[model samples]
Target: MAAAPTRIRAAVVGTGAIVSGSHLPALRALADRVDLVAAVDVDEERLAAFRALAAEPDETGPGFTVTGYTDLAAMLDAERPDLVLIGTPPSLHRDQTVAALRAGAWVLCEKPLCLTLAEYDEIAAAENPDGGPYASVVFQHRYGSGAVHARDLLTGGALGAPLVAHCQTTWYRDTDYYAVPWRGRWDSEGGGPSMGHGIHQMDLLLHLLGDWTEIRGMAGRLVHDVESEDVSTALVRFANGAMATVVNSVLSPDEVSRIRVDCADATVELTHLYGHTNDDWVYTPAPHTREAADRVAHWRTPAADLPSSHAAQLSVLLDAMRDGVRPPGSGPDARRTLEFIAALYKSAFTGRPVHAGEIAPGDPYYEAMHGGHPDWAPAAATAATSATAATSAKEQ
Candidate 1:
């Protein structure tokens, strides 16, 4: 019999809701393949709560008895885990990732990996020169069975050349949602829905559509009283001559996450709020000929129904770790998505279309997403400034 694969030792860096709800569950599901040894958080109370929560029994067996730590460096030195799952805020991602990589641990980080292109470069610089300790972002939407099928079809020319596409991530977040200190700030959460919420769909769109050449975008503080834009929209031109429109908003009541691709032979769409299964996707063939219509049957034939979840991506990452190879959603692939985001923000703030490779070293946007523009100030700050000025004028 072939030797059993070595189970990797994994550690999680945060005990917040995302970690408890997604990362911990994923580790439990893959328990046979991973040993979660430690968890870290700044808050002692939250850390204790997380330990209690992890102690709960489940089908995967008795809960993962993980040691909790307040300092990440201490956890790294003590645990020396093979894999680190980062579920912390966007601001802390660069430093945490670099620390993990230097300690010879592969990282699977949550979305909006870092605040800017420069920060991304810093994290990337920390990886092993070969490939063993590479860091990958968690873009789960690309792992679903439907997405895999669509990628094969679209890239293999089965769906014909993709000409146009639409990607939307519209969800509602009221004042209470932004009550968290880091929620609405550009420095912490990155750039609103375009970076935080819509990024999942945006990454998936880029995954299917290939490289983007240029972006023309607009953003506004439409509704919510926050520093970042409540809504953003962009027109993207791809290297393959495909054009796409992207909309990211946190102001919509009827929440939906959607992506549609119009190819020469068919139209492919996947619609779901947070996660998607095979059932959420539909492929419609152009009725130009009987043979073209007949191909729809093959497209509808279901593969293994793997839903897009943290586990799905983790499974792939685990395989890569075992093989000692770099995985998808890492290195240049991740940078592409990050660069596109920076381009969108630059275009939105500067009122000019931004191109790929335009925001390189020394570029203001390379160091920060807002590019140091006064126009990009948060609405809350701007409002307060105006109020103060009005009161001073009346007193004078």
Candidate 2:
């Protein structure tokens, strides 16, 4: 047998919530294959906290010895890490990812990837053409056993052609949640739930349904007093002639993250919030045929229960790194999801159905998801003012 691959040296940037809660845990779980070498954060307190957290021993092994840095460049230069985990805000993803890639380190960045298609291209440009140092988006939902099984079935005609689907990501985020300075702004957080919260479900939808052909969407600032919309809805048409409805909201009391696909032979559904296991998926056969029922018996997820999480995706990324190949969530595979998000925003703001390949280099949407629409926030403000005045008059 070939020799076991050497342990990969890894570092993390932004010791914020995502790093502490998600990425760090993932790194520790894969300790046998990776070394948590360093961490970077602007805040000294958070950096120190991360260093302490990294040193905590787990049941399987001892902890890591991670050096802390206030500057990413300093960490990159000093450590010369093989992998870099970026958990910063969406606005900073492009620059930071580019920086890591340029430093000859592979990158796995958190979702939203970047603010626009143009920025995504910039990140892609920084990669080595030979495929050693690539930047991947952290879309862990696609790595789940349920999703993998579903995508195989859907694409292989096991469930027949997907006809109609619904992708919903409705979760509550109150005033205190958006109290953070970067939570609600367009420049900081990118778009609303459509870009931030719903993108995960949307990416999973695309992963199962294949490429999307067109999108017609609408967004509104229904509840939140912020620069971005609190709720958004869209109708998407897939290249396979299937259509889907997508609803993303942060104002719903009954929170749910669900995707249901109605195929010609049967229906497959996944219902959960944030993450899901194989048990969360249901495969229902069409009542009209016995063959559909028979296939349902074989249409099952892997026996092992691997919930969709950062660890699952990170494990795959580690394998790819060992082999020196491009990994999932990199290059075109990652760009497809971000492109769909850009199209949704363009269609919502422009009030037109956006088709694939339409938002090219020069299009405003290519530069930013909002497309720099001058009327984006003003339109919502106008409606809110009108509603408030009408309510006041009725009270008088």
Tell me the alpha-carbon RMSD of every candidate: 6.0, 7.4
**Candidate 2: which pairs clash?**
none
How does candidate 1 score on lDDT?
Answer: 0.89
Candidate 2 residue lDDT tens string, 131-243:
57989889999998888888888999988889999999999999998998888777788888988899999999999998999999998988888888899999999999999
- Candidate 2 wrong stretches, greater than 4 Å: 1-5, 59-61, 290-294, 377-396
Model 2: lDDT of residue 385: 46
- Please, what is the whole-model Cα lDDT of each candidate in the order they appear? 0.89, 0.87
Q: Identify the runs in model 1 with alpha carbons over 4 angstroms from their true place.
A: 1-5, 59-62, 289-294, 378-396
CA error at residue 323 for candidate 2, angstroms: 1.7
Our tally of clashes for model 2 stands at 0
Which residue pairs overlap in candidate 1's backbone?
227-378
TM per prediction: 0.93, 0.92
